[model samples]
Target: MVRTAAAVWCSASAVVLAFAAIHLNPTRSEPAAASANGNHAAVKTLQHRASQPHDADQQLNDVYRSHTCGAVAKANAESAVGQPGSIPCIGDQVKVAGWLEFKRLVGDNVFLSIRDIHGSVQVVFRQEDFVGFTEVRALIDKLPKQSVVSISGIVTARPQTAVTEASAVEIAASSLVVLNRATLVPFDHQQTNVSEELRQQHRYYDLRNPKLQHSLQVRSKVTQVIRSVLADEGFLEVETPTLFKRTPEGAREFLVPTRTPGQFFALPQSPQQYKQMLMVAGVDKYFQFARCYRDEDLRADRQPEFTQLDMEMSFIRPIDIQNVIEKIVARAWLEVHGMKLELPFRRMPYQEAMEQYGIDKPDTRFGMKLQNLQACKELLSQASVARGFRVQVPESLRSPFKKALPRLIKELALRNAVTKPFNGLPAALEDATLAQLDLVGADFVCIATGDHAESVLQRLGKLRLAVAAELERLGHPLRNPNEFHFLWVEDFPLFTESDTAQAADGTMALEATHHPFTAPHPNDAHLVFTDPRKVRGLHYDIVVNGWELGGGSIRIHDSDMQERLIREVLGADITKFSHLLKALRTGAPPHGGIALGFDRMMAILLSARSLREVIAFPKAFSGRDLTCEAPSAISDKDLADYGLKLIAQPDTKL
Candidate 1:
């Protein structure tokens, strides 16, 4: 009689046994039937089994088993495992399985590179080892690149020089079994014929490339760092509904038809309203790695769907929130790139920034300041008079110059032609006059290097000759990219006058430059009625290298101000925001938050040309995922299952 049981082991030689033996005590009862037959039969069987002592051990050896590897598992194992231990020595005989990433045929011996969950190892096989098996060589040749294979061999430390020179160490090989074959071409050998469309269609393959893999890894690290930092700061990671009620903010939403007829849900453009509502619910610190969707034009920095680290905190001033974020961003930079940013970054008023830089988000890295020419009218007037009596004046220029003088003077608001003393003109008038003349004579005085001083001045002699020949072709001088001008625009107007659309009540309305919820500055609230353009909100944006990294504003938590902001300023229907109004009435706390473009941050950090390079599966310029073939038409069955219907597209006569 043989007792059979199962055993497990990491390697073939190490047998593991189960502890299932039962203990018998004097107090325990025994079955009457067992008592009659067990004593005589057990005694005889025990005596018989003693004659064959190796039976139990042989059965245990047979029970131990190994697993076969697959392609994806092999890839996962390679990444999961660490480098082999130092000091070459043979370990226990083990059976390992994974994909053979590489192999080299050396005369009659083959060097095989195999990776398993434990790690990768190099295996050597001699021709004589498989002397009776011709099929082994044929199978080896037929093995697909990246195909899964199992090898049972004695583990041994690699030779000293071999370990140092080789990409991988450790050699083992006894038996090999192919598990799964990879169908696609190896990533390195993929053809040039591969199209962007095909790459997107087969995104799994596209992501296999080392460059994309590393980029996605970095992106993951960035998000992890953000989550860790925010969590440490007492931020609650709350998830908001992706399907939301449609409310017009700015960008259009992708509507989802509902099972209930005539009703629909809109995909969230952002978790803006919900996060604010969280503040109302007494969840003071809330943050989410939000997925935002929008139906709008796409650019390098813009995506149909993108991610942002959205955060909001209650009972805090605008500056408090800004400081928290500044610390987080600085820490992120230091942790990720080992660079410490200057504390308390400079803040600029919106109005002043616009006036000087002609746009917000001034790149403070370089300088070519836009000089106000109106302040220097005295210089312009003097130069004009001196030019008129210059020794060399072309006859053709004299008449046209005189004709243009009146137009320039009128545009500059000159009091008189010659009688208006330059010094007596107002500062604004002087600056305007100088800026106008400078526009007409916009040639740079290029002093050629190594030229004689007299000869360099001679180059100026050709100015009139060149201007006469190509006056129509040369208009204004080109902007120089080398000169970087940095500035902070402050005091941005809260509203802008526009005529794009009528208000909800069929009346003219003022557009909130930021948003309806942004709070007006305490001192500027009264100016909203008297002069809307002069009123500024408690809003701020951080711009660097001419890119808007993030923006936020103090929110209107007071019910009265919130209602007035929507009704009077934005001209939005009061009923449309009833839920928000209700929340505001429930003792909402003062709060503000900012959402930074993660992709754009990476772009600036890496100095990449486009944000797409930092994204793993970025949509094309037209907002189509070429790799996944997304935005493809859905099957009628799927639509029916979801209780949806497709709207007919308008016909075009192209």
Candidate 2:
């Protein structure tokens, strides 16, 4: 049942204990050779003397001996694990039963420790105390680790025992029952070098690891907090389609073959189209913990399926959209981190962020802000004159980035910092900055110049990150994980030349930078038709610590504007969007919303190295479910029924 990228909802207890991940390794466990079905029996020898030691608190430990055991001690163990409320239930007889985890024994006295999901309590056994049950006495000595045992005992106060995280009281058991027995533990999961492959294969055992349990608990809590805040703010939770039509030009899709031959349903890339229609249908506010799927090659930040906090609001302006999202974000911070994020997070234009940090999602924790070489006539002359490369500028300046990217990438490879699949950024970068920017080393200063401003900034952005990594190793704390630098990058261009699009004569054509529905900035209205490059849209992306956490835009509500932009500017066909086009014609209200990468945020909150750490059963970067060996070939009969042909046979070799 290990489905790749399956959505898991969180619970309240999980949320509270999510961050409580520190492991309480048992002070004592059975020796490795000790097994339930054992033949070669070896036990650590214990000192036979069991007299009143000078340590009075240690002398009173019920686990060591039954100093007090009687019929009076037989109530619920949970109420006695810790003192009930403010009052001590020290003398209360408790009937607590849970799996036995740890034990210690002296020659004449034995100790048994048990724990339930709720709490842990100690049980004491002495040979003299169990007079009537010789068989039970032998069983107690033979019981394996993780044996399910229930014991009735009197809770005795131990004022002399060392006060630690565990309860200050012990239970002197008058009765015991071994409900079930467990075999020897499978492997040493605590090993630092334990492979992820092993963990995924033995995932059930992996979850038993306290650290992973805590992470999952935290994930549960974060989502619950977000859901609560959204509900209080009047956002209606709604369900959207998982199986829908293909958005062929968007992120790659996972197609589900249908009953009809050659027909298939695509898993949604986002709840984008449906959520917009909801706005048109007068659902003023809509949200979902949406399950989204995309079939692109995988990375640490991506899964073939993932969760997004899908939201849309009607009759809202650009700031209105930003305000609500900021509120949710701030509330999450306050609840989890106990700090108020600076009200109305700091905003920068797309151009400003790109120029300053070399990336739209800038990690502002460190100061390696890119300095424009051209800012100084001397620096510009020095940069271009020494170790220079050339870019062939194109006449159209359309998709010019494609032409400019190669040489700069080659330069990065020269430095041994760049490689294919390069953008899989770490979940957290602690204090990594462009220390190299300040270093006076005997090497060429990296400079990017190109026809398209975006192309130049994009290349520089990659180099900025590369340098940041190098700086961290060089001892610079530029991208500090401890810092929360939430940024709003705004005024993104409304259109860019689509890589997949072509003009009538086979030239690249323009498409919405974000989406066709995004509204052009009111100030850029004049430039929409005149110069697409300068026409900034009311689109924004929210980032933290260099990760693009969420993105949204003020959607185009005006029918005439939508039509003109689609037909005259972008040259996209209008007939296919008839439903949305009709809704706009019928007077759609201005709407906008943002979708937060929920899983990515969890990774950040939990300090995980990858999204898979937060996800329950995430597929590997190869897009295969390692636990179940999925992405396996479909049955030949089913393929034939679906009228599909094999392009190439799947390799049947190891």
Candidate 3:
């Protein structure tokens, strides 16, 4: 069983001959086959000599693997490699490459699991067959997990009682070449509970996790489906500049300094203006997988830089844009998830959504719909509307009120409330209200009241989400995670009270609800000059399972309205948007568009808790790139080149 170097060469020669006959030429005369085999073997010998590591360096760059682990597994399944008296159709001599995921030595057999992007396979190296089994096993043991290796072996049926976690068919390895040895990883890639900081810091290792791998794969598939659907809809894929001018929509923008003093190029928050300009340029329909940046506080769904599925169209109404978007979404869902979405998604006006669900992006999967307590004559006299929602306390909690009440109060910011047994209901509540809400077993009532019904409902909306979360924690979930609820929330007010700007009279200003470019609703157009607050915009938001997937609006092609909204209502500098205003004046067609948050969409589709799970290299919660450690400090000389200087150091360490 102890083979020498000469014996190893002979065995290698035999493998080369077998590979040539099985793969190079399956049908040949005996003499021709023998001659061809000899030539191939000689070539293989020369390759081996050329690939030999010089001195102590173990790197080999010439090993060409012919098969993937996925292909090997497929071959096994299709050819019935594990069935009795069955032979696989794949050639016996196979060369495959991947990272070493696992390894074990049992008796004379060495079992090693190799994983590539497509899949993983098990390779069994035996002392009887491998000349330097001891040496190879020692090297494999010394190498770190995830070390890159190329294995040359014969594909064979796994033993009936092998009891392995590998593919049905396994490889009997003749030789193993260490392509690249990895260092000790910070944490095991198989671990599920690794800290987010560590994961983000070591994203390369994080990507090795199967969950992330699958998420990335699904992301790619979703993108492909979207592209295909958009292309089929006659939409041209366009690319807009990421380096854009400073035109504030709402969010803070990341500024890139120029060599000129006090001059900067701001990263685009979206491709809104560019796409509109494209519409003016006579590009009837356009779409982009646009890269957008926002200098804003981080959240589970927000990233500093993200991809947006931006689209625009000319000479179209709101319904036309909605129909096209619906088609793309329906096709994407059907192709990627094999789920047929109901045609023409349900639409809810902004007023109706706020009145009923307390939020524009309502999760229709569950019914904790807010109640109008002001419906009662008694409560109506006190406030504009008494917004309340009831949640059933699970029986699992022995002290339900003691555990849930404190959290609910803090979350909802509820200052006024009454806690009593179901039998001791408040006198203000009507019997019909109780019956309609189905509050028989419910032990908790969260209510918010104010003179402004909108204000009250906004607070109660937070309570609704908080209550649902509390119920889930208490072992009773009102919402189904598996459900898909698509809704179009429309009829938003054209202008809202601005939080930042002020009027010339020192009073609060009005701002565009969606954007200044959004046109007023046709019926409400006359109110724009009379009562702008009452005028509604021709805007529509696509909501799914409590998330605002995307939104769009019919844009104003007339420069007068655009300029008025920017200069008068919004109190914004008209000079900043002169380009857009000029484009609008140049016979621009009435257009509309939508931009879907690609990261948020993927996260919801894959059931990921945070956008980070779907993103390849996401920043930490503080908008810091943990992988590259970005938002780094600039050297004084580099800053001088940009004609900038740091006036003061940060209050906290980065």
Candidate 4:
């Protein structure tokens, strides 16, 4: 199921009350105001004037009032009722009254979905069912969604679990009443123009699809399960500001200009601050299924707006928070997929992870471990052949092997440049370097006719053997498909070199790897000023199947450290976050939190190629919705409503 971040504006209490009312009176009277609404008026008129009531409404109401709408009533009605047009049937001979949603008309029979009061109900009719009603055939051909009609037929239950099965059934029409006609554009007619995106824009019709209906239903259940699980764990489900003052986070904020003029409120990137503030307000635990917005590039796994299970707790250690999350996740898995997840999942340090897998979130399901070439360079050079093959060297220098050594070293350095500075090559590389290796012969060669051809060929063969051996070694068990590897990357560096290393104030500054709020290790406090690279924070990430599922850290609860960290590491003045600092001064408890990607989780659960498969209405890869035509040109009046103006491209003369 696609997990969508949709807010259920209706209160749960209202749903419960509505269900209760329906249960209390199965044959409840229609509202007085609805008496003149054509269809209801027809039913009411029949009920009031009939000397002896002969409609299905009167008969069904009688059955419901006497025995109620449950298994017992259904059983009694089935035993007492006869086949269509047969005598000794106590209930009135009624026709199925609904719109034909879907249809298949054979030579003399039809199978169609009828849009009844309760939703779509399937009805199957044979030629005999409407033998005397020629007009019904014409009506059936033109029947569309939301059309209202009454067909008098013998009611019976279906024999199997086919499309036409329900507690009640109808057959053999004595008459056809066209109560209301529908203006529906048939599905076939919209084939060229109706994309899924467009269908979402026209969600009313899209909801009629069983697949979408099931997906949305499952989504609702997931939300309910999340709410129930959190509430049970004594977590206070709180609402936070959707708009607030923007701060420098990882992503660009979606800004909403204010009526007050000049000032603006940024749609939340995540409820990070507000949830933490709950802890300051003495609320021990806080959580919200928050809608987060980011004005950034979109991808299959990302949206312009998304949701996160934002959570925070007071006076809790890192392990405490992890345990809470474990329980919540385990419960969610059981509820959603009916699977029990293992608790206390394995944790691997960030440094260890990069050294082994070259990725923070190592997909535990496979093994293709990265090896460090630098560690075993000397040993590899000593080997006449590396990995059982002769090493290849360019012929352009005095000593071909000696000259290429520098190039090889440069290549190794280039590979290391992309990863964290501290990470090194793996132990396997060292073992391979120590072993004598040879390269296999290449398919083609460049010959120097003036030189001794035999000697040149022999040397070239040696180089080919070495190259083949090295390439073969590089291709090993790391590429195996059967293994699943889950990893925990922790103790990430507190700061990293910024794009512009030199500060405007001529003071040294660095960019925070995670965020300024992350608390550095106590032992590394001094290094925060002297050598920022050496400072490690209490940060951790959960990586599974090669995807970073979530990340979090123990937050800086101490006000002084928070300000200093921001100024020293993030290169930002304290004034920008002064309000947050002030909140911390009010005796904020030690807190930490993580945000789980709900859409990504669903994508994993469904084994979907993209998050779009799980989503009911997702934009295209370019973030365009062909169905609804969203993010299109807005009207000038609409732009004026929000106090905004559009700036045309500089070169566009128009």
Candidate 5:
């Protein structure tokens, strides 16, 4: 009857069957619960492989390591011999397994260096202690570098004069077993001159390098810290859908077609709408390490697909969101850099950041604030000097600054550079310019003419960064690289003028500076309908050094406000975002969220030159996955399954 009952349970769901079987059969359950008991004799033998010395010295064995290479080194360093409550040290037998890194022959002794994922250690084989030393030495000589082997040995203290970084102690080998052998590798692990193409092709080997290993380890530690901090703050980790409908949020998206004719699903550029919906679902605090996609041109800081530290909250102002993000960032820095970051970072309005530094994301670590010279035209007779800035470059940087001046002037659509002391300028114009700016003997000024006030400031901002870069290259950095300057840049203009686009009345069209979801500032709310360009969005960006760490805004939860901004103000297609509007109408709360660029964050932490260094598998500049050679051709039959056909070849130039 019991057997029949168990068989019946097995016919149901496997999970249900397993539960039932465990309850019904004590014989089966006991062994599964514990490693060893009266029912299992093999446990004793399995335990013997870890610490006990083998009876025969020359005999090969299949059993592997009892401790890691790192662990072995740590054990010996704790005490001279062996200490109570610590791992085995001198004169104790142990087993270890790893790939061979190198081999050396000295008289009648053979020395081998082995390394695993954790660390490396040295193994020594002596003729006096081994019965078949000559044969083993010959075999070791024939083995290739990076061959996998397991060796049982007795631990011994390394000679004081002979010890190096590989290990502080040496292992006296009892016996060895060959597990596998590797072929000759393409390039040395640390070879800097290796071509990137070849290294990418053999990325598995490339990842074995110590620098990459350390980078991955740090990445894991930082991610763990973020998870712990968010979890402690009462945030629930959630996974949102990636296959979503196409909507005009920002960048281009990757489209996935279905068998249903003309029906398609687009990969989400972000988890924006879903996270907002999570707020409506009563998940008050939510977060995810989301994988996002963007079908756009790539750069050093960007990839076709990347990870984002996405999060959202309900019943929060812009400051509330900023505070939470600052906590997360501080915790992450503490874990990596072992320093406490100051709380309540400095805040600067977008207008001030642009006016003083010439860029929205300003690196406040250095000084060289831009000065608006609009007052100069009032002192001069020239009427066309509509907008200008008095740029003062240091005398020490005059040569490099001069070299970068011509290119900067051409890019900004500005006029010539003016050296101090009024070389060829008329006395009146020179006096007007000098009077507007406080200039020392080492400072020179450049005044842009006819450009808009905003354009002039932005161009000067570029010049600010350029000067900083040149200063650093010339062995006189403006500020220390290690110093982190955290700032909150907020109160940005809601809209920007489009270059080639026009509105319905043929006037200049406007685009959202951040996104359409951002609510206008309380003081500027009325301006949205009248003069939208003058309205300020309640958006905030967290910047560090010169990089925009992340951004978020207090979103407009009211359906009416959202629709007006998207349809009437920005002139976007209403139908594409109707679903979001419907969700908003279903009694959503006042909510806000942020998505931090995880790749860029990692690159910043590691001080890596490219985002590809931090990513496990990143696309090349040409958007090609060199490892697998992806984005390959699909067969016609496979295309038919999706109810689609290739229209033309992919553009090689793209």
Candidate 6:
């Protein structure tokens, strides 16, 4: 049909006759006649006007002088013609303007389409309809795709052949004008495998592509929904300072130096401190569109700076925080995807999650659930703790690991070993402990044991993901992207032995698994000082499709206990936390909060490959902003004033 339109637009008089149809019958009570070939009789008159191109030119000039090419938007067109798969603004004449998305020429007519922020519409230009406006046709012919233009025309019900994204109705232009012109793009934005560097360099052009536009739009709407839902739940939206004191909140913070030589303020890793302070201030609830920063190793999913929907509440239980976040999450899914999730998402304790899936954040959509054979074998053992037998899965699946397992396990043991054990396993269960269980469809099962059980288990978890990916590539998709599976991984250990931290005797000392402030379980409070390893924090993490969506924990309110935690378990400076300690000592209520990775949520909502796709202007893998060429060296004088210096290294270094 586009080809036919191209052929029909060959003649130049199609616009001349279209003008007469509108002017001569501005409000004709009867419709124009259609011939046996489906061509309007007016089109026949257009052919007759072909002999007088000069007269056609003059008529178009008059129409151009008389009509206003003001503005009619894609949104206006959508509103006027709101039916699905079709626009129906027949007989309504208006001026529309937007970037020319497409163009085609036929016998004596032209078909053009334009796109604006809201949507796109098709414009039909009959040469006869323009009368003497030959310049209008000339303007279109000379312009490139994406040229901004305006058209004054009557909305006519399109013929059956004309149905498309523009719908059942189209504007038959009597006059046209170009507002701006765009140069041809060097490459197709539709190409999926475009180079990342090139796309980042030309992010503006990249965003103009429909895919990026759609993603940002949905992101905006979902954010609004989040705000609305939270507001309805009594969360007071608040803004906190970007420049804060250097307090330990994990991840490296970017420091901002002041004019006072050595003074510095650190950027927040999250609103963790401020939100907790809000709770101390007696604020019942608080939330913020928080901007967080971190100078960590970069990946496709990690950014130096990102956005999070951070919220906190006072006098709330772990379940209360979970319920609050669940509603917002469910609301987001409903508003963005129009699907209501089942209420009360599933729950799994941190240990169970680790035992079953090998990771705290488990993608529950599909399963290659892990089995703890050692735990099962303990009851069967008559002697001490069963140790040491390595069972590689079935022989078929075990062939690849000529020596891979031992090497990786050794590496994990060095970096993540909780305790160096006696390696004592009863001879009988030695083989079973290390034995890999051969499962139904899978070629083999993976099992690991050591002081670094969590570490080894995490490695096994990654291997599980890789295997699942391979199976999907081979035609069995275990984890479907379209399905969302959410569960709360609760009852996290209050303390874990940090690989680098050490006790007085030099053995690995206990450190806050989540943070120093997390309160221990009521029953486990006595173990905080005696056996930190056994204490469970009242914490929970919300996992969705295998991603750690968000996490929160009940906070410690007792100053003495907080001091004991800081000075003993974590072995940190109590003076540094004097402010938080004083606040806790004050009359404060039990409080808890959570911060959702808003950027990741956006990526999940749109199935974006990475968080960068959802961010407006993300930095490159090198942590440099390509668009503005950021992170450049500062002036020598400015550095000197800030009490900073640049070391002159050998020319061999970057």
Clashes of each: 23, 13, 0, 40, 0, 52
The sequence of per-residue lDDT tens digits that candidate 1 reaches over residues 308-341 is: 7788888887778787777777776776678777
3 or 5, greater by lDDT? 3
lDDT of each: 0.57, 0.64, 0.75, 0.55, 0.73, 0.69
Better candidate number, 3 or 4, judged by lDDT? 3
Comparing candidate 5 with candidate 6, which one achieves the higher TM-score?
A: 5
Candidate 6 ranges with C-alpha deviation above 4 Å: 1-88, 131-138, 183-186, 375-443, 449-451, 648-654
Worst 10 residues of 3 by lDDT: 25-34
* Candidate 2 Cα deviation (angstroms), residue 157: 4.7
lDDT tens per residue, model 6, 175-275: 45454567656457557788998888888767777777788898899889888988898889989999987877567889998888789999988878678
Highest-TM-score candidate: 3
Whichever of 2 and 6 has more TM-score, that candidate is: 6
Q: Please say which candidate is ahead in lDDT: 1 or 3.
A: 3
Clashes of 3: 0
Winner by lDDT: 3
Task: Encode model 5's per-residue lDDT on 1-654: one tens digit a residue.
Answer: 011011111112111111111222321111122112212111010121224345223124324577666556554644544332235677666667787878999999899877776777788877665434565577678777777777656678888998777556888765555556676587877567998778777777778776787888988988898999899989999998989998887789999989998998999998988899889889999999999999999988889999999999999888888888999889888888887999999999999998788789999988777755556565533544333334345577666666766665566454444323233333555654555564333254544444466776776777777767765776666877688899999999989888889998899899988878888999999999898988998899889888988888888999999998899989999999888899999999999988899888888888888988888778888888888987777889999998878899766543
Residue 604, candidate 2: Cα error in Å is: 1.3
Residue 382 in model 3: lDDT: 66
C-alpha lDDT of residue 219 in model 6? 86
Which 10-residue window of candidate 6 scores lowest in summed lDDT? 1-10
| Top-down TM-score ranking | 3, 5, 6, 2, 4, 1
Model 4: per-residue lDDT, tens digit, 1-654? Answer: 111010111222221000001111222221111112222111111222123444345545532111111221133143554443222232334434555456667677665555532344444455543222243344466556455544433335554453233344333232334445656553642255776545556655565555445556666677787788788889988999898888987778978777664678899888887877788898998888888888878776787776677888888777877877777666766776787777687888776665444445655553233333333445334322211112322343224434333343354433221122112233454334434221123111111111322232233333333333343454422333222344567888888666567767685547888778888887797888777879998888777667776778889999998888787667787786888899999999998888777767666655556766556667665666645666667677877777777786333221
